[model samples]
Target: MSGDSTESDVAQETTDDDGPKTHSTSFKIARALFGGVLAFTALDNFRKLDEMIAFADSEGAPAAERSVPAISGSLLFGGLGIAAWKLPRLAAGAVATFFVAITPVMHDFWSRDDDEEKEQHAIHFLKNAALLGGALAFLRVAQDD
Candidate 1:
């Protein structure tokens, strides 16, 4: 066989069922960083459970006592799963749910009367919204994978 034909054959052989193959170093790094951030935040939440609960309570979240642990555990496991690329769709979904659930509850800037507090909450709310969008997109990509 000619060199060009042999090279084409090698490329075809490397293609995955999903599609054409490519190095995934950057993707892997991004996934790990995303997971690491979530995991670290979860650890912090656990370390400050009482404070988290108090903050949740102050924010008027229903069942703050029960929700704190549940959310923290979800964040820890979901983050790890994403990092490991294990059931990443589920992990991304969990993270997305967490963002959706907490956004309005914790950062309801509309409810704040003070301008500074309103702006602060609005910033957090928008940030979480962006994260949620990213998580959802990741979920789609994971599903495709």
Candidate 2:
């Protein structure tokens, strides 16, 4: 029987009679890292709304260009990131893809001349990345629910 029952076969056989195993300790850590980041970011967005708007205005961005857009986007992902708990694989992949696409644009340290300026740029870039990961997690849990 042991020779015939490969891990894949056993996994394929899992059913309602034997519910899914609980999250492992390491998985719990990863989940917390992802979900907590998004949830915290969603909370953080509120504090920065006016400042972000002001920064956009100061930067001479168009009227349509505002922190609100990023905030809303982050919130959507943030909620999704938290939800991603139940659907970790897809959620993780999506977040990684999203971050990869957006990171260079958001965190362009190579172009910025000043060290302080680069530092600031990096911070913003990391924030967006973390949120992306978080949102992935949130969406996963959401999908599961």
Best-fitting candidate, measured by lDDT? Answer: 1
Per-residue lDDT tens digits for candidate 2, residues 90-126, read: 5455555556654665467667899999999889888
Highest-TM-score candidate: 1
* Model 1: pairs clashing at backbone N, Cα or C within 3 Å: none
How accurate locally is residue 3 in candidate 2, as Cα lDDT from 0 to 100?
Answer: 72
lDDT of each: 0.85, 0.56
Which parts of model 2 have CA positions greater than 4 angstroms off? 1-22, 56-72, 83-102, 122-145
Total backbone collisions for each predicted model: 0, 17
Worst 10 residues of 1 by lDDT: 14-23
lDDT of candidate 1 over 1-145, digit per residue (tens): 5456475665565456656332367667878888889889999999999999999999998899999899889888888888888988889999998998889999999999999999999999999898888788778667556
Candidate 2 has what TM-score? 0.50
Backbone clashes counted, model 2: 17
TM-score for all predictions? 0.84, 0.50
Candidate 2: residue 73 lDDT (0-100): 60
